[model samples]
Target chain A: MLAFKLAFKNIFGAGYRTILNIAVLSFAFVTIIFYNGVIDGWNQQARRDTIEWEIGQGQLWHPSYDPLDYFSYQDAHGPIPEGMREEVSAGRLTPILIAQASAFPQGRMQGVLLKGIPPGQAILKIPTHELEAQDGQVPALIGKRMAQSIKMKEDDRLLLRWRDKNGAFDALEVTIAGVFDCNVPTIDGGQVWLPLAQLQEMLGMPGEATLLVAGEGFTPTGNTGWAFKDHDYLLADLNKIIQSKKGGSGVIYGLLLIIALLAIFDTQVLAIFRRQKEIGTYIALGMTRWQVVGIFTVEGAAYSILAILLGALYGGPLLWYLGKVGWAMPSGSQDMGISIAEKIYPVYGAGLIITTVLLVVVSATIVSFLPARKIARLNPTDALKGKIQ
Target chain B: MESIIQIKGLTKQFPVGAGKFTALRDISLEFHRGEFTGFVGPSGSGKTTLLNIIGSLDTPTEGEVTVLGRSIAHLTHKQSAQLRNQHLGFIFQTYNLFPVYTVYENVEFALLLQRLPTAERRKAVLDALEWVGLTDKMDSKPAQLSGGEGQRVAIARAMVKRPAILLADEPTANLDSKNSHHILQTMKQLNEELQTTFLFATHDEKVMGYLRRIISLEDGRVVKDEEIIMDKITEG
Candidate 1:
């Protein structure tokens, strides 16, 4: 208790020096929490967007289908199993037929993926209802990114060519029924959506699908001639990307902590060096050498405590405001080939704050103790004389 | 006339380069309660060394020294600290007050080590400050005080706990003659009123004039041990 009292007195008595150290430490404290909070928020936003716009609760893929390998689209799909046909009709599962195709817009050839889904499907957030044929023309939906690249808009006509299962090529004039805006780049760029019946007829493959998306809360059972992919498997890539970003941010955290701790370490060393007489005075006043060490160690740890108070003074309101208004990501972020939204609101968990507090306080204490241990070896007589030991 | 500090054949040595330099040779002494005693000598005469052993700040190389009935040589670090905290007090020439603490806090520090109760501690601190006539400067930091005031605060700090023995090493070395005499008179009065054994190591003549007993040393050995007749000398 005496050590704590004296430590606080000494720290406050130090005046501006104490404030400077606290400022640096508080910077580290607030920066760490804010950076991690932003990353966590981005991860959460990306995960939700991917789930809502692309993968629902999970997915079921055809046995031979490989989403990453474009050549698999040629022969990856098969007839939908009889057991899952009821699920498809009940809207619990939505089947999608994908084919590698080419589109000619303004006489410019561009390769695209033609995905066919039920016009009235409600499993995903895509504007598939606009895919209903109108006025003897095939109506299709494209993402804003795809529409921008093709220079096509609603009601614009484009020539789409694809090969059927019999190696026969077919061409058709499709009208752009709608252009939807989506944050998930993988679901947006280079993709066009059309009615399942039209694509199936064009490909001469009826009742066939490349994949099945399970709706919210839907659980797969029995044989469906397809592999059930759970959320963990479906979101593995996204999780890996998030983890990688966190790893990169870890370096910044380390550098910040090291800088703050280095300042504290230097101050501790200097205090011990200059306060020899005061140390001797404590010994002379009946304090044990260990007690003297405790005073110095607590003095250093007290910096972190002060910093926590200082950080909360300014950082609290700033963090709260940021959480409210969110951070707007710069334009063209969608082209990074990963899921990111326009604005991300940071999520600061109780665990993050507690863990950060412990990390800083514990680190400050250890650095303080390192230099204070030298006091145990100090000769009281020499210290009284203000002689270096 | 109770012997509270007893020393017999004490020797202290320090390492200088490869060889050991003996600071204090075989020496024996006894200090009774309430006596105003001073160890007088020139530089390198081992005055401070002998005082340090009595204060339990340093141990003897070869002797049995006892302070307040505990063997100084055998006392562990904690026991030595307890001995100092409970029964002994120390004052240094440099007035080693904690620069950050105020005069009241400095005086209260010794009593704090004893963990005195709050009301009692406050009373004791105020009384100690009153003794040094520093009640008006209780809130002033050491840096704000003059050298004499600083030394007086150090004296108050040493006396706050009312220890059985007070060891002062050149307490008035940094003071002018007037301030030195004033500090000595205050200490002499405290010694008389409280019967607290006052032991000082100094070469200052002003301090020697106030001692009831003087032990002079030359080269590491006691050269003269005498009792002063206070009535023969006029008050300064």
Candidate 2:
């Protein structure tokens, strides 16, 4: 406690210098954490979008569903194999069908991708924006781009046009109950979701969803098309897909780590140079090299704590506001019906924030030793003579 | 008399621009317990260097230095620091009281090395300040005091640890006549009351007059070592 108090007093003894050092360190901390937060935010958004569209928490597929797109559902011919139903009921499985279809809604005509889903089971696989209460049934949310192209709104009736096995235009008029804009350009512009029952009735295809993703609840035991549950593996797969879609977060983290180290190093060196005389006095007064080292290292730890607290205090709300009212997209893409929610989400996880703070403390502590070593080895006489380097 | 400090054949040299400059050379001296002694020399005559060696602030290149029966010149770096802390007190020409500390805290710092309890430390520190007649200024900083008051605070800080020897380098160099007299009287009284050995290096004639013994040096050699009765003591 005495060492800590003395170290703290020595640091703040020179008011201007201490404040200057803290300012430089705080700016450096902010820069590193900001970049770190951005990478985390981008990865989170990418992962959420990927889980919603490309893959899910886990996937269950037919036995014949191999790597080739053409080899789907050829092996397991039937009504989702009975056992997978148990997995879905236990919140471990989600069913999806990916099929191509044509959409003719008044003046808009285009071929679109259709995703058939069981909403209750789908929620377990891909997270959705939890909607508010409506009348009897939950609203069927359409992509913003799809809604804009057809000039549809809540309760507007539009025909879902597709081809049936009879080689005839099979059309069903469905109400556009809600609009969802998940900002992945491909998904928002071209896809629509329908209930599994409705999709089966319209396309005359029954008993099989194109893909089924199962989460951690079951272990596959032989030739039953059952796979073991591994949450780590599932997260890794999701992370890989996310990285491919958005970008590598590691590069940003690496750059910020280097920058933070350099900043702390510079601040500590300057502090040591400024306090060489005080260090000499301390040494002359019977403080050992190890005690002096501990003192300065603790000072570095204090600075790390202060900078992280200030950064978090300032950074959290700024990111939240950015996520809330995002920027407007460019005018040329105005026809795509871009919403504010999708463009600027700066969401972050607790683990990522904690890890970043820990890294800052470790880096600062390490950097402080460079100066502490110089101080510990200082000869009191030479140091008093002002020959400290 | 028991020797508080002994220096035999001591020499110090510094390297400067492809040449060797000797600061002290083949000096021998002994400081006895409960004595007031002064070292007088010209600039560059190495009074400060000799004092530093005695105070464990500097090491001799070619001699033996024993303080309180311990060979301080041969001690390790940490040992020398402990020697200074346990046995020696230092008063600088500028008083060297920590400017940021109040008078009480400045005195308390010397006692911090003792690891005394808080109540004992406070009592001893306040008592030391009272001995220097600066008890009223205990809460004031060094800058708030006059030159003599600041040096008194420095003296209090030095004596607070109850060190066996007090070493002062140019102790009166920065004082006016009145403050100089006050500091010398304080040191003399403390010498009589505490029986602590006081060693000083100075160019001030007034400082030398207060001493019972004088060791004068020239070119790092002790040219004169003599005892003289202090006239001010007889008058007081």
lDDT for each residue of candidate 1 in B1-236, tens digit (9 for 90 to 100): 78888999998999999999998899999989999999999999999989888989999999989998999999988899999999888989888888888999999999888988999999999999899999999999999999999999998999999999999999988899999989998998999899999999999988888888899999899999999897843463
Model 2 segments more than 4 A misplaced: A20-57, A63-79, A82-95, A105-109, A117-141, A149-151, A154-189, A195-198, A201-204, A213-222, A225-238, A241-276, A289-294, A305-361, B230-236
lDDT of model 1, residue A348: 96
Predicted structure 2: lDDT: 0.69
On residues A107-223, what C-alpha lDDT tens digit does candidate 1 reach at each position?
999898999999988988998889877888899999888888889999999899999998898899899999999888877788878899999999998999999999965779998
Candidate 1 retains true contacts at a fraction of: 0.78
Our tally of clashes for model 1 stands at 0
Q: What lDDT is reached at residue A91 by model 2? A: 63
List of clashing residue pairs for candidate 2: A58-A213, A59-A213, A60-A212, A60-A213
Candidate 1 TM-score, true structure as reference: 0.97
- Report the C-alpha lDDT of model 2 over A245-361, residue by residue, as the tens digit: 334545655666566566657767776776565565666566665777777877876667767766667766775666576544355443432212235455556776677778777
Best model number under DockQ:
1
- Pairs that collide in candidate 1 are none
